[model samples]
Target: MNPFDYEVDILPLSVEDGGGFTAVAPELPGCRSDGDTPQEALDNIYDAIGCWIEAAQEMGRPVPQPRRAAA
Candidate 1:
């Protein structure tokens, strides 16, 4: 498993062209995904994050920590 943490920010869902459910990641830039349904979108995005981490490691890059921002 990757050495990091996770936190999901529940935001209002949105619709996109071609009709897919979308959710946003509160922390990472350009880290969002869509799916056939809300739950699917969540699952898809979860897997996407794993791949993102793998790519980052293979390329000798640092993975971002999912820490809550200070208010």
Candidate 2:
């Protein structure tokens, strides 16, 4: 499965929170990452998604399919 196929939610962090951005893959629980910018956050999350899927497969866990937008 392609990691980019999954939807990612990007949120900005406050100054107190280190002033970066966080990216999360909602469909894959506990899969998330943070970066100094939104684009960086997205890049990090994509890598995380691949790792998450790989670990799940190695553990014999079922990987959830990504939801697609309607036409």
Candidate 3:
């Protein structure tokens, strides 16, 4: 599955938190990444999504389908 198919939530980090953006895939628990900018965070999250799916598959866990937004 394409990681881009998944929905992502990006949040900015405060200065005390090292000043980077955090990207998370809410459907995939613990699937997240951090980077210096929103774009970077998004890129990292895509990679993270792929890894999350791969790991789940290797462990015989079902990968959830991405939820679609209402039209």
Candidate 4:
């Protein structure tokens, strides 16, 4: 089976919400998700990423792959 090795960065910011902070992907606008805690936010962002990718595909737009650094 092929591996899903693509990258997606999630940034956890200090901006306060109702009871917790938010996590977002700067490269993938509208791909934001929140949680009650840092760990939860990280987990939620993964789901948000999946949804974002699906939406992009359905819209017939190519989802830009995350950039990587050369070693």
Q: Write the per-residue lDDT of candidate 3 for residues 18-66, one digit (tens) a residue.
A: 9999999999999999999999999999999999999999999999998
Q: How many backbone clashes does candidate 2 have?
A: 0
lDDT of 4 by residue, 1-71 (tens): 00122343444455553667577766677777788777787778777777888888899988876654422
Q: Best candidate, lDDT-wise?
A: 2
Q: Supply the global lDDT for candidate 2.
A: 0.96
Clashes of each: 0, 0, 0, 0
For model 1 the local lDDT of residue 20 reads 62
In terms of TM-score, which candidate is stronger, 2 or 4? Answer: 2
- Compose the digit string of candidate 1's lDDT tens values, residues 1-71: 33224454434454446676775665555667777777887776777667777777799988777775423
Would you list the rank order by TM-score, best first? 2, 3, 4, 1
41 Cα displacement, candidate 3 (Å): 0.3
Q: How do the predictions measure up, each by TM-score?
A: 0.66, 0.94, 0.93, 0.71
Per-residue alpha-carbon lDDT of candidate 2 for residues 1-71, written as tens digits (9 for 90 to 100): 99999999999999999999999999999999999999999999999999999999999999999996523
In candidate 4, list every pair of residues with a backbone clash. Answer: none
> Could you tell me which 10 consecutive residues in candidate 4 have the lowest summed lDDT?
1-10
Question: Which segments of model 4 are wrong by more than 4 Å?
Answer: 1-16, 69-71
Q: Worst lDDT window (10 residues) for model 2?
A: 62-71
Whole-structure CA lDDT of model 4: 0.65
